[model samples]
Target: MSRLIRGVGAVLLAGAVLGGCATHPNSEQALQQAGGDFQKVKEDANVLRFAPKDVIRAGESLARADRLSTYWGSGADVEHYAYLSRRYSAIAREHTEQGLNAERGARLELERQRLQLALRESKLSSVQQQGKWLEEQITSLATQTDRGLVMTLGDVLFDTGDAELKNSANRTVLKIVQFLQLNPKRVVRIEGYADNTGGEQENLRLSRDRAQSVADVLVDLGIDEKRIQVEGYGDQYPVEANASERGRAQNRRVEIVFSDAKGQLGAAR
Candidate 1:
């Protein structure tokens, strides 16, 4: 009976030792896995830059797990600490990625704001330049009318009894070109008039021909043809009486009328 009791005691001791040996390898594997995870977290640039505190905590936990495993042998304490280290490492990596994404979003928003501001400044500069050019054109044209800025090219612009434009009239035409180029949205109406001295049919034909000549010149100068409207009003809407040579010259003229934003013009007096 004493021998059997001793034999049972020996078997129980061997079983206890084998269980400890198995636990030891599992604890070692957990610790190694934790260390590898922490190593990966440390190598990330975002983690280094943004999560230094979390990284330090993870490293300390892994070190504690290693020390406990070495001194106390594989146990619950070692496994708990290893798990904590891995969890902390994942947290650090996640926080680092979030921080990097936030920084990138902020930079993109700032860039968008800068581009918008630049575009506004450019538009302002363009508006000021257009205003300056328009003012100069209005002054040089020497037009005084209630019909939204009318410019008159006298009979001298065309040869006697002919629709052809004279070379000397190029200066006046170029001024119109400059104005049109600056204000692309602006539209104009060209009205040609003749004196009462000519026959009604002949005067109407000559008037239309002269107006078409002016429109062609503007189109040649890069102005859109669609923006220009032409008409012939024989011996009509004359600015001066056709009783004398000076008055007749003024009556036989082509008047260009600028319109409002909607291309609507006021009646010419």
Candidate 2:
């Protein structure tokens, strides 16, 4: 009975030792197979940089699974597998995070660009169709040299104390831009003017600033900068005297001057 018990005990010990030894000896190979091997993974990593949405997810999965298998061994294969799995996991994670961030950023940027493009297109269409008077002035720059047409500061463009064009003015500017685009041979002169309420120097500065403001708006709207000549006329050329606030308000404006063969034609600043 004692010998029989000892024999059974020895068999059980052997089985346990065999079981321990039997662990997937080739876990490295297993990992390689599961993870698509290192060379395959390197290629996958390279493609992940610019790969479309579907490919990135697939590679990440394969690399992750293979790496875990490599982690399970006790021999050199074990450390090697473990290293492979760890390294692959890190790379996979890094690629995923970077890719996600970049994708999100690109999506947001694309949406913004689309909105901007639409706004520009809308402004161009609406303004060009409606502003017949404005279009004529801008389009006939070279031919209508001496015909002086005056539009008050409050009537055509710009806002109070701001260089930026209001949406309404932007619409007008957009119309002018399209007109100029159609008539590339034409040239425009932008003049800035200010009321006599301020000192002469200040008035000149303000006038010039306002004129440049108009030119800037037009430029941003797609008109060529070289086609526009900017000038500032202080209170010296005001249509209204500096006696009343209303008169002063009328004087604070930009004029777009057109040089016809004969002389000045339309004033739109």
Candidate 3:
């Protein structure tokens, strides 16, 4: 009976040694992996900045695991502490990434708003410059006269004896339209004159048709018809004598007379 008991005791002791051997390698491996994780986080500046407390906790747990590894039959305790250390390191990295992402998002949103503001200011500046240029162009085209500010459209803008305005007049007409749009309170008088080439009644009819055609264009280009007055002087107010073709060309003209800033117009001739 005593011999059989001794044999069983030896077998049990060997089995215990084998179990310890298996657990030791696994615990050592766990401690090494945990140390690697902690070392990486400690070296990262952003991880320390955002998750200092988690980093400290990870270091403390790893130290406890290292101390337990030196003791005999403490494999399970070492593995538990090592696992805790690894978890703390992982938490530190997650927190750091989340913080960095939030900061990046805030910076991007601020930059977007700044760009939008700059774009709007640039557009406003461009519009003001355009308005100033148009004002200068209109001033250059007009002459201050007893008949108020008058801009002349020569006979070259129309066909011979025809009232239709040619496409060559597009630039001048667009300038007038833009000016009227800017000065909404101002009005205009479109006056037509003729040379003495035709009969009295025919000259009067043609002059009136030419004036009405110019007024129609102003209305089509978005100027209110109420702001325009049409008149025909026939051969009465010629700028030059009808002796030569050049003088006749100068006499045949349509003049746009602008009103004052308060919408007051000069008396019609």
For model 1, the run of ten residues with the poorest summed lDDT: 14-23
* Residue pairs whose backbone atoms clash in candidate 1: none
Give the C-alpha miss distance for residue 24 in model 1, angstroms.
17
Ranked by TM-score, top first = 3, 1, 2
Candidate 3's residue-wise lDDT over 1-269, tens digit each? 99999998876566455543344889888998999999999999999999999999999999998887766588898899999999999999999999999999999999999999999999978876887798788779989999889999985776557778778878999999988887788999999887788888887888888889989998999999999999988878888888988888777778999998789999998
**Residue 237 local lDDT, model 3:** 83
Tell me, by TM-score, which candidate is best: 3
Off by over 4 Å in 3: 1-24, 39-45, 48-88, 119-134, 146-148, 177-189, 195-205, 215-237, 241-248, 257-269
Each prediction's whole-model lDDT (CA)? 0.81, 0.60, 0.87
Query: Which stretches in model 2 have alpha-carbon errors above 4 Å?
Result: 1-164, 259-269
Per-candidate TM-score against the hidden true structure: 0.58, 0.42, 0.60
> How does residue 42 of candidate 1 score in lDDT?
90
Output the worst ten-in-a-row residue range by lDDT, candidate 2: 142-151
lDDT of 3: 0.87
Measured on C-alpha atoms, candidate 2 has an lDDT of 0.60
Query: RMSD of model 3, in Å?
Result: 6.2
**Candidates sorted by lDDT, best first:** 3, 1, 2
Compute the lDDT of residue 203 as modeled in candidate 2: 72
- For residue 148, what is the lDDT in candidate 2? 49
Better of 1 and 3 by lDDT: 3
lDDT of 1 by residue, 50-97 (tens): 899899999999988877775434567777888999999999989998
